[model samples]
Target: MITLKNITLRRGAKVILDGASATINPGEKVGLVGRNGAGKSTLFALLNGSIHEDGGDFSIPAQWRMAQVAQDMPETDESATDFVLAGDTALAAVNAEVAAAEASEDGERMAHAYMALQDVGAHDAPARAQALILGLGFQNPELDRPVNSFSGGWRMRLQLARALMAPSDLLLLDEPTNHLDLDALVWLEAWLQRYAGTLLVISHDREFLDAITNVTLHIESAQLKRYGGNYSRFEDMRAEQLALQQASYSKQQDKIAHLQKFIARFKAQASKAKQAQSRVKALERMEKIGPVLAEADFTFEFKEPANLPNPMLTLQGVSCGYPSAEASAAPTTIVRNVGKSVLAGQRIGILGANGQGKSTLVKTIAGDLKPIAGEIVQGKGLAIGYFAQQELDVLRPQDTPLEHMIRLARDTTQAGRLSGQSTREQDLRSYLGSFNFTGDQVKQAVGSMSGGEKARLVLALLVWQRPNLLLLDEPTNHLDLATREALSVALNEFEGALMLVSHDRALLRAVCDEFWLVTRGGVLPFDGDLDDYQRYLLEEAKRQREAIKASATGQAAASVPAAAATAPVVNSPLNASSTAKPVPRENNRTRQMRKELEQCEARMAALSQEKQGIEARLNANPALDEIQRLSTRMAALQTELDGVEARWLELGNALEAAT
Candidate 1:
């Protein structure tokens, strides 16, 4: 349990939180929701004791240990598996010993260390570690390979995994789902649902928040308000709140106007002096509109591309990304080769495990990267509008909103592709207004705007360009869930061929018709709905993991006698405790086979039991009437189980063959 009283947090005189107060009880899952830059992270820090609030007392049980999932990490040579294991401080020390022993050169010490490793269950570490790695969307062979080789996004996933793996009384997760794909994201959502402690997550993911959060804590106008509902219900409640606030504000304004008239008229005549005084007293007593919060709704008109034609973009035997070794081994071409024909109004989503060439493929499409080899053809009259993930990089700091718009205006006579009468007044005003940008904001320098404003400006510029083809890379980054939905709606209505790279599952589902999955191995064209795409990704990843486990378990189980394998395996604690013995070379083959068979059976039994258990739990959920996070997780797990079973059966046959 934690409580905040009269909390005020300021970052350099900029009010992050003003007089915020709230009480979070043990076992409660609260979602901290606010617009971007509203200090949701700062508030989380305050609750977690990472940062001090300027003026508030936040209290919680002394026994409660709070943990925050950091968003950044220092570069290191640590493997992704090792880094995640490091999350458990206890496991870290144990793993360090094994690493140290492996590094030592003495043969005698090596044998002793090997025995110690077996006792600690180090042999099975690969299986457990691979599960986490695959669940986090790192299909990179480099995960067991090295952290130093990964980009920042992959590194963030490692850090996220570490924090999630660490046991604590309360978890303060800030955008935990940011870098995760549908497979990883769903796995994480399911894991968090069963996490045995309180959780307060700061996320713009409406689906995640709606599923995991039991309460919604709003940080607005320097105050904290609690809503007893998930995100969707919270949205409904907020609508009601805004209505009440507007009604009250309007009534007060009317009463104040009447009083002003009375005061002016009675000041000289003394006829209405008492009534005017009474009205002034009433105004003083009135709760002044609690921090006038502005509401912004993005309702944009689609500027249909001129003379748009079908089959906007096509890639046959075309690949994207820095070439992997397999691709690199053959010829000088690195990007590899893939195939796809993107048709008219194709709302395609590109998804793959991080470190795959998704960004590279999109870059190739944008002409930012050269494919090592492939074919790409653009449709006739196709114009291009590209949005990169780093909106800041794409936008000019020196440009004002109006200036940016003016720059987007093409000289119609020169290009001769479309109309050239684009004036600063009409085009600039219309574009900015489409993004909900108005008044002084139109003249404000882009450098002075917040991340959200910058993102909006980028969209505005894109809309003005009016290209027949739109390529968006993580456009949902700065936008809140509400704005994201609005953007999704706008994109759905927009008449263009869309190729978007995003980790937001909900957004992908809303905008895309097809998917281009860029695995480090190669690119695969996924022509299916969002659900099918998710299954394909997860199944592939899970199969990879099961294969790894099957290999390791075969090796591990090989040490035991086949005749003794008839006994049911006892439940073993994951922590290192069991002592293991080596099998003589003669019995090694069958013993290994038996171990693999047992491991596969155990997993099958566990999954089957878990499936039924989850079903009962779902039926008995407390908030059955309310949409819950468990529901989503249940669906994801069922998918996971399906994949697990399919693999389990294959492994079972293999074990039989070996025996």
Candidate 2:
């Protein structure tokens, strides 16, 4: 259990929490929610002991193990599996003790260490780590790859997996679903439903909170208010309270107005002067009741397109993928033979597992990537506005909102665009005001803004293009609930076609009328809804597990041959068996070693790239602190790279001997 009483918290001179008190019972799934910068995170810090209360008390059970997703980006050459395995610090310590005891030949100590390992389930730790990795949307091949080889979003997922892998009595998660897709989000929801530990999560996703939490903790006006139910029920309770407060406020105002009027009329007369003075004193002594303030709301709509063709675009036998580095090499196909027509009023949702080519399809349609084997025909005068999942990548960090708008306008005017007319500075300011960037905010640097602000800026830029076709990839990743609601409302009212890839089920259900499933190298129409797709995922996971079990059994059986052979068996894809000849089978150990070797090579390549990036930064003259940090990180990476190279050579030699 956790308890806080009269907790007063501050950051520098600003008081975030004053006289805030709350109690969370053991095993309670609580949703901590409030407006941005309303002390929700500060309260979390207080609970985690990172910040002490200025007054009052905070307490939690000392025996409880706590786990949290780290906010800092991890820089290392550790494999994803190893990184996650390190989360169970207790299990790792027990294993180390067991190893040390065996080396020292301590019989009693070894027995005790082995018992401790068994108690902590150390024997199954690797399997458990792999399960968490797969559940988080990582493929089997990615498990052995270095953590730094993945992109920032993928690394965030790894951090989440690491947090989930830890055995904890209490778990703290803040915006856990920000980097997830719909598939992984569904899996994570199921996992949380089965968690036995206490959970306190801070998120801007209303639906997620409603699905996972049983209690709601709201911070407002420097007070902590606890509600008995989930976010939806909390909303209902808050609304009732606000309504009653507003009514009482109205009645009190009427009485005050009557008293003031009587005092004004009687104060001028000598006989009634004493009575008027008494009335005035009574009025002044009465405690005041302030009016209830409503929560702020945001609303914005996309401009109506000037031209809406019957079919916005058509893909004929399209195969989407990336091109090879060699000039004459064929492109690597990801999605094969896709034929589809996107109509002007169509609202299509792309659904698939991670790395199954959903983004590939969107990029192909948006013309960011060329189709490998087919053609995409666009309608006459077609204008497309594409929103990538990495919102900040498309934005200039050092530029202000006003500068972004000005540059966009200049580009469009120079390019002789038709849909959106050129706008001056004042016009752009008024336009940005509708999106909540008003007054001096428009001049604020984009780099200094919050995630929600950056997301809004990206939307503003997209809206200014006035495109007839919208290709959005995770557009609501960094947006708050209100902004997501606003985006859904606008998308519903949009006249042009939309191809959206998002993890927010509420947004997908609200805006998309049809669904396209990208799976197994093909794009096809799904005949069911989101619920059915969830069922499909469960069955698919089961199928994959069964296949793995069967493969393992077969490999174990094949390890022992019917009779001893003069030469060892070697299995290669290039060695095809025919009626005239037969090929030898490959040993599982050899294959495993080769895969690890490949992963090592990939890690080396990533480190080399990082080295180049550091050199470039140095050339550009970075800050002294930043330069020191980069130099230290580069040196560590180089040391790790050398170790990987040595291991790679050993693996190569072992593979050669096995063949």
Candidate 3:
């Protein structure tokens, strides 16, 4: 267990935590949450022993092993798998002992070292590392690629994989989902649920916290408050506490009055996920949390559009992708043959796995990238407000909010997009003030601002345009919970067509009415809700892992020495035309079939074992909810077993034919 009694922590002259006390029990998954710049990371640094408390008692179990994602950007050229494998400190220690024992030529020491190596599971370390790598969204082939070859985000993912690969009693993850796609995020949640360790994570992703954490640690006003249950439960309890404060009641009432308009709008537009009972329940909960959301520090709504077009834009067999740098080279098409219409008041969420062109489609529609083929017919006098995934795309670091707005006002007016709009400095400053950029903040360089401020600046620019259509890609990536809630409310109130690509499920659930799936070089309506999409992503990940396993098996079979083969070779009708050699040799097709057969048998055995374990748990009489979950899993296992059995039979018939 960890304990902090009357702890006072400070960064230089600023006191971050004053008289803060908290206890974290063993094996607890605690989500450390707070508003941005509330010293969450500072607290994490203290927990990790990077700094000490300014005053008071702070202690942790000395024997507990701690693992955390390294914040430093990795600069090594090591293979990804090898780099991750190095995180297994226990295995590495055992191997070092083995080497020392061998050098000493001591019988007893060598015996113990070998046993320790086996105990640490050193033989399968590479496989374990590769599994972590793949689960974090890396391809099988990329496992052998150098770490430095990947981009900054991909490298960060590798860092996370390395942290997870370590055997530890305590794991510290800070914003683990920031770089992950929805599929990877889902896989990570499942992994964390199965982890038998104490976890402390700091993340702004509400859904992620709700899914994996049971305890919430909130830091506010120089104090640490512990609450039982997940983030949503914490929010509910906090709201109740605030409601009890008589002085704040009247203020809250005023905010609630302001929020009533959004609530009415929400009621008017029924949930697109009506078929999902859980989503419907979430909608009901949102209605209850209206007042709490209204107390947020920042909130702004889009102005009424200059014009409303029935069909904002129409794609006629469009291809969304990137153009080649060389004029002679062909453009790379990611999402092709997309014939869709964006009409007034439509809210569409773009869904896809990483590298599936969700962003490409949005960029094409935002007019940042031209379509590789076909046409996009825009309504006359149509206006678009686009929020890019990267701040660099829309913001200049050296410029201030005032400069950005002034330039926007001038350019739009000169281009006749914002006819008769005021370009006066005073007018622009007032406009920026609505988005919380006031006083000297309007003059501060954009690069000096926090991520939330930068995002807010972009929103200010977009809303000022009074666009009929909004294209947003990962806009909530840097936003805190309160800011995200504010954005949700603002978006709900906006009477404009919206197309968004984001990994933030809460934002998607609140803002999108329909979903478009970008996959396999094409676009189509998903015909399902977010819940169904998550399940599909899980199944797709499983299939991909299986395919990777088969590919690995085939590679191993191909690398085998021809002379080491034990099975007799036979020519089937499929290869009857080949001339026979004097010495019998195994054909490539036969070898591949054998390898696949072996893999299938292994999978069947694993499934049977897992089913037996589930049966044992079920027979033990677990809780009602646990029983239901286990039953669902059991059914899925049975279905998979049936498919595997059918494939086994087919393989047997094929092998017999070859014989």
Best candidate, lDDT: 2
Clashing pairs in 3: none
Prediction 1 TM-score vs. true: 0.70
TM-score of each: 0.70, 0.82, 0.78
Backbone clash total for model 2 is 0
lDDT of each: 0.71, 0.84, 0.83
Q: Count clashes in each candidate, considering only residues at least 3 apart in sequence or on different chains.
A: 6, 0, 0
User: Each model's RMSD to truth, in Å?
Assistant: 12.5, 10.1, 16.7
Q: Tell me the deviation in Å of residue 179 in model 2.
A: 1.3
Say which prediction, candidate 1 or candidate 2, comes out ahead on TM-score: 2
List model 2 lDDT by residue over 60-135, tens digit each.
9999999999998988899998999999888988989999999999999999999999999875677677777777
What's the residue-level lDDT of 519 in candidate 1? Answer: 56
Candidates sorted by lDDT, descending order?
2, 3, 1
Q: What tens-digit string does per-residue lDDT give for candidate 3 at 1-659? A: 99999999999889999999999999999999987777999999999999999999999999999999998889999999999999999998998999999999999999999999999987567777887887777765467778886667788999999999999999999889887877789889888998999999999899999999999999988899999999999999887776665446566556556555455555445572343444445445653332233334788898889888889889999997555444554554556899989999999999987666677788788887799899999997688888876754458989999999999998888877877578899999998998888899999999898888898898888888888898988888778888888899999999989998888899999999999998767898999999999999888777766666666667668778877765555776745756755666789998888888888999998887665444433322345565566556666676788899889889889989997
- Top TM-score hit: 2
Q: What is the lDDT of candidate 2?
A: 0.84
